[model samples]
Target: MPRQTILGIESSANKVGVGIVTDDELIANTRATFHGAPGEGFRPTEVARHHQKILPELIEAALNQAGISESSDVTAIAYTRGPGMGAPLQAGAVAAQTLALSFGVPLVPVNHCVAHVEMGRSVTKSANPVVLYVSGGNTQILTYARNKYYILGETLDIAVGNCFDRLARVLKLPNEPSPGYSVEQEAKSGTKLFPLSYSVKGMDMSFSGILTQITAQGKKLMNGKDTRWSKADLCMSLQETVFAMLVETTERAISVANLNTVLIVGGVGCNKRLQEMMRIMCAERGAELGATDARYCIDNGAMVAHTAALMYQHGVHINPYSGADYTQRYRTDDVNVVWRNDVLT
Candidate 1:
């Protein structure tokens, strides 16, 4: 199999990532984020259009970075098929399918969330335990059980990143470039004294109220109250509150699921404080945690490639036909990559 090379493309959100893998070595992992959710909130259709506008360039760049002369070197083409924007999924599907058709290789449809799990394993070297996926569109606690991945808890309203961005807007922080990064930087410098409030559900969480509380606090300062809103402090507070909820919820889920190892994925996982919280909690319980290592954290193409490489070993390769479909609402359980290859074949 010539070491089996897998090329992965991820366009599930505001980021466009491309990754390549040869055997266990990660050849290339690249991403381009379209800083779109600062002020204008997220519009799925708009984001999809943005992806469609740049799919070709990203795919080629990744290939070039991997030093591949042609598609023939690619053993499989992997892409995030669903649980993302319809338009963007279509664009990526078209790209993957085109490459598959041209190169005569299998087109592996990967679950975006599961890609996190795979990347987490690559980063942390864990053999499956638990996953905390907190991103712009999703907040979920998942674990593989009964031959299927189960969602232990999730958000009732908005995602964690969405809440952060909303709060950043209220604070009128630097919305340009990376708002999350900006908020974190501001929080490091912030020394204010405004406290945010919120509670975590048994396995679920609510971030909207937290958002409102911080917004109200910021508005009070605008009313000429004698206050010092150190952007860093507020950022620290907000991060503390949200990260605590996630850590508490994750701990509970771990206790109930009887799993110690926890893999934290998504953009929020990029937060050092959140990673530290999870690490400390896991250490207290004698459970290993997978949160650090920039490779798996945040949305990127390498995670996608890493997943394809593993699923290929598990025999999840399925070549799409000429009329194969790209789904918009695909469930994790619906696509059983582990043992579905023979059945479908």
Candidate 2:
């Protein structure tokens, strides 16, 4: 029997990526990102256009890197379907559908959030752990139960990545790689931890208040009028405060679920400070912490392809001829995880 080869496309946000993978090996993963001005965020329309413009090249590059000249070599095509900007999601969906139809292969629609969790699990080999999913568009505590990822808690307002990005913009920080990355770099030089709003209600967390306070402070500092805090100081305080909330909530969730392992996924999961905080919490509780580097944690086609490969092996797929669809409000708990059947040890 021939090994199944899956091609994945991801354009849920500013990055457009393509990946090729076999059952147990990653062949190629390529991406193109759109960067806006330092103080401006990417608009949906512009991001969609960027994906559309660069997707073909990314696909070709991925296939070439994988040493597959014919599209027929691909067993399936998978793409991110929802819980992202609608226009960007549509760009990827349309490309996936077109590729699937042309190649005469199955098309799989993967939930972005589920892809992140599955990728983290695959990378860390974490078995039956409570998940802390954090990114630009989402923040949630999840655990698997009865073939579904149940959400234990989530953000009440803005996501942690968004909060970081907003603060970066206010301070006119470079958005070259990402605003969050820039903030993290600056935070390393911080000497003082300023007091900031920290809101964690029960299991749920909120970052809007912190963002608002930090944004105001950042603006004043950027205008060269405020001497109360340095850029590094502000960045460090923001991370310390928000990461504490996340750590506290995750600790509570782990305690309530009685789980011994905690897995962190999504774009913001790449942060060293956040990982350090989570590590401390897990260590204190005698639990283990699992996380992947940016290659797997950040939004990329590899994760989508990897998750789709798992689903395909389990006979989960859709018709290629049907209309490709996507949604901006797809929740993480909406996916019925048929591929996972692990028993907690």
Candidate 3:
């Protein structure tokens, strides 16, 4: 078969990313993130504007890095198609549509969640693994079956990353690189693990209570009234408490599915502590663990491009003029896994 090249654009949230990929190589992967003020979270409108302002440059840079001089060099243009903020998702879709039209190529819409999973598989070379997808917007345990990713468990209220971000705000952590990163850094120095609420109903988890407790504790710490726990200790306790819940749920899913591989993806997957905890759990079960660094763990276009290339290869694509639109609440299980032929082990 001839080689195919795909250009992927991702603006599902605060980051705008562009990636170029061929059948055998990742030609380019570039991105820019919009950092909100300290203690302030990103709004959809502001994030969309940031993506719009930076997308063109990122696209050009990606293409240049791949040594492609014209849009025609790309076989297809793929963009994140949803389960994200409406405005940010639209920003990427518009760019993708324009690129497809300008290049006279097919336009592919990729599920943001599926992209993360595929990227994890690609990077880790895991054939068929149970997925632990934890990000700012999502937290789910999934396994592939019958041409779909089945959700074994998920967050009932707020996601794990959101929990960290909220606590980061309460602690007034910097949001420059990321709130989660800052929280992770602080957690490394934490020596005490306060008793926080652990709410796990069946396979679903709840983090709102934990966030609330930490927020109240954070206020007291900031006021120099809570000498029992420092900021680092709070961060540490949160990580320990939440990560334990995730590990417990993931282990259950792995056993239920009888899968030997566990792949962790998403922004929070970049946390070394989380990775360590997951690693220990997988090891205890005699299962292998797969994960990617921040570049692929966070929202990025390489995963999208790589996934799109797989979809395109499997005859999954739409005409550029089909008036393709993004869906804000697209679920991970909503996608048909047409590109994957593997079954659960």
Candidate 4:
């Protein structure tokens, strides 16, 4: 088959992204993030409005970056269909449908989680590996089986990224770029690891308890109480505790899957500390660790484009203008892996 370009749209969170990917390579990627008020989280409607307002400019920028004409150069239009904020997903869906109709191309629906895993594999070239997917809204350890990726373990409560973001807001950290990034920097200077709750239920973990403990500490710090912990210490401790839990769960999952390679994906995967921890764990077990830089780790359009292209090539696609819907709770195990070889695929 001849190589073709795929254009993808991603508006799963505060960031709105667009990118172009060919059958073999990513050509362009562009994104614009919406900043929320300090100590506040983004509202769904507000995020959707942000995406709607900037999507056009982002698409144009991505096209220009790819050095291509409009939809004419794009062989398929792919958009994140579910497992995200409704309004934001709708924004991407609408834009994608419009592009598909305009260009007379097929509209491919891409699962957000599946896209992350697929992107990780594409970049790292890990043919088959246990995947640790972590982000602001999700955390799960997955591996491919029968016809889908099965979740071996996941967060029982809040996601690790959400925990970090909330803690950052409580500490009055700047939200520029990302709160997690700011926390990572402050943690570098931290010298102590404070005591906090660590909850692990079998293969699953709970972050709510840890978050509650940290929140109380943050309040005490704000009130000028002599809690014997600095904000940096708290940040560092939070990261260490949460990342340790993640690494442990991933280690177990790797053992269960008996896989020699591990791939970390999603927004929180950009954390260097997490990568380092994973490296150590992989080394201890004599396994390979596969991870990408911020470009592929964070939520972006390129991953969607790449995944959708693979699906399209394998004759796995959805009809254009048939149904344009998004969901807030799409699970990774629900999607069928039609692009990759499986007994069902």
Candidate 5:
């Protein structure tokens, strides 16, 4: 069997993930991180500007790292098509579509959230697990139903990961890496001393109030009766409060769905506490939990490439994406998921 190489480009957010994959096997993933020019978090227009400047170079680097000289070497070109900023999404779409045309191969447009879910299946080989996608731009509980990625529930407000990042910036955390990682790192040594809000309604959830409460809690700890509270304590409390909401909501979703397995996807799954907490919940309920390891958990080109190849192999693909537009509002229910079917190819 000839090797099928897929080139994946992910510029949905600050990190541009470029990867080459043969089916679900990863070849090389190169990430180019871009941050706000002068402030914190994302300045969409600024990221768009940065994308234009760095995208070409990053694409070249991905191809170089894959040791492929020409686009013709790739069996297919898969790119994240939507559920992100229009400018950023189009950036990768244009690049990928061009590569596909230059190689005269097929183009596969991947949904960012679905790609995240696919990462778990590629690794854990779980069947029929409830999916929890927590990322900067998305908060969704997905399961395949009636041939589509069914949306069990989602954020009525801000995304969990975005809420964390924004809260981190509010606490003056560094933007070098995401606040989720920072919060997790800080929680390691911090004692959770405050009680924060947790709201998970039905299968849906919200986190903005809790984030604000944590920030205020931190401020009170710094200036209140207990002025000696450690920063670790603050981070720990925040992590706990947030993780609790996630766990509670996911558990509720699992029970409602009547599924015995859970798959934790998206960048926020990088949190050890989240994994552990979810593990405990699944254990107590006698349900299996499928959470991708750090490498496969975070948003990377590998997931995008892996998902795109799967989409192509499943025959769920689009074409003429050279002028392919970006989708600022890509939802999980945008397309039906055709799992493990030969007709997909």
Candidate 6:
């Protein structure tokens, strides 16, 4: 059989990514991000415009990187169809629709969260693992059973990454590389743990209070009120408090599911501290942990391409011109896993 190749578009947030993947290998992954100044956040309209401006060049670049002709190289077009900022999602969907029509190929619409998990599983080769999906806008424990990715537990309020980024904003941290990464770097010198609310209700967690308290403390620190507790201490404390909740919820899910493997996905999944904590928990339970490369952990077109390729190969598709629409509130469990059989374990 001839190798199958797919072009994927991902513009769910500030990042606009383009990727190409063959059946067995990833060929090219390109991305452009809209970076706001310190203490500033992304606006949907600006992000959408950024995507619109860069997508055409990015698509050409990705195709060029893959060493293929745009006319007849790709088998299908894939895109992050939902679970993202409305404007950004719409921009990517429209672009995907246009590209699919221009290329005369089937369009595969993919759920963003499921694409993350599928990419993790594909890269790590971890079959039927419990997934801890933590990102800027999401935090959930997921596992596959009966042909669906069941949500074991999730954030009841703000997501962990959002909390970190908000705190970073209060501290006037740079958003160049990433606010979370900056927080992590600053946390290395932290020696004291500040008191912050930890809201873990049964299995689900909440970070709203944590974020609020941390932001206040950060303001006070900026005003020279709490000189004893440095910014590093606050960052360290935030990570400790939040990641503990995540680990606890994930462990509970693991115990309940009786699964031996845990896979971490999404932007926050690239955090070294989080990965270490999950690994420690998995080790104690005599289980294994699965994680993708740091690059793949974050939102990218490759993951979307890989996932949509699986669905496209499995006969799942939608009309690019008419039926393809993006959703801002798409749930991970809402996607039907038609590509995989129900796992017995």
Note the Cα lDDT for every prediction shown: 0.77, 0.92, 0.93, 0.89, 0.77, 0.90
As for candidate 2, its clashing pairs are: none
**Model 3 per-residue lDDT tens digits across residues 138-182:** 999999999999999999899999988988988899997999999
Candidate 1 Cα misplacement greater than 4 A, ranges: 175-177, 219-230, 333-345
Model 4, which residues run further than 4 Å from truth? 342-345
Candidate 2, lDDT over the whole model = 0.92
After superposing candidate 5, which stretches have Cα over 4 Å from the reference?
1-3, 37-39, 218-230, 340-345
What are the C-alpha RMSDs, in order, of all predicted structures? Answer: 3.8, 1.1, 1.1, 1.8, 3.2, 1.1
- The candidate, 1 or 4, that scores higher on lDDT is 4
Clashes of 3: 0
Clashing pairs in 3: none
The segments of candidate 3 whose C-alpha lies over 4 angstroms from its true place after superposition are: 343-345
Give each model a TM-score. 0.88, 0.98, 0.98, 0.96, 0.89, 0.98
> What are the per-residue Cα lDDT tens digits for candidate 2 across 215-313?
888888988888779999999999999999999999999998999999999989999999999999999999999999989888999999999999999
How should the candidates be ordered by lDDT, best one leading? 3, 2, 6, 4, 5, 1
Task: List model 5 lDDT by residue over 1-345, tens digit each.
Answer: 566888888878777778788854677887767765222677666776777778778778878887889666888878887788877777788778777777888878888888888878778888778898887778888777666778888888888888667656655666666667776787789754677777878878887787777667666654664555566777777778767877888888887777889998888887888899999999999999888766777777888898888777767666654455668777788766776432211
Candidate 6 residues 168-275, lDDT tens each? 898988897788888888888899999998798988998998988989999999999877789999999999999999999999998999889999999888888888
Once model 6 is optimally superposed onto the true structure by TM-score, how far is the C-alpha of residue 50 displaced, in angstroms? 1.0
Model 6 lDDT-worst window of ten: 316-325
Q: Name the runs in model 6 displaced over 4 angstroms.
A: none
Q: How many steric overlaps does candidate 2 have?
A: 0
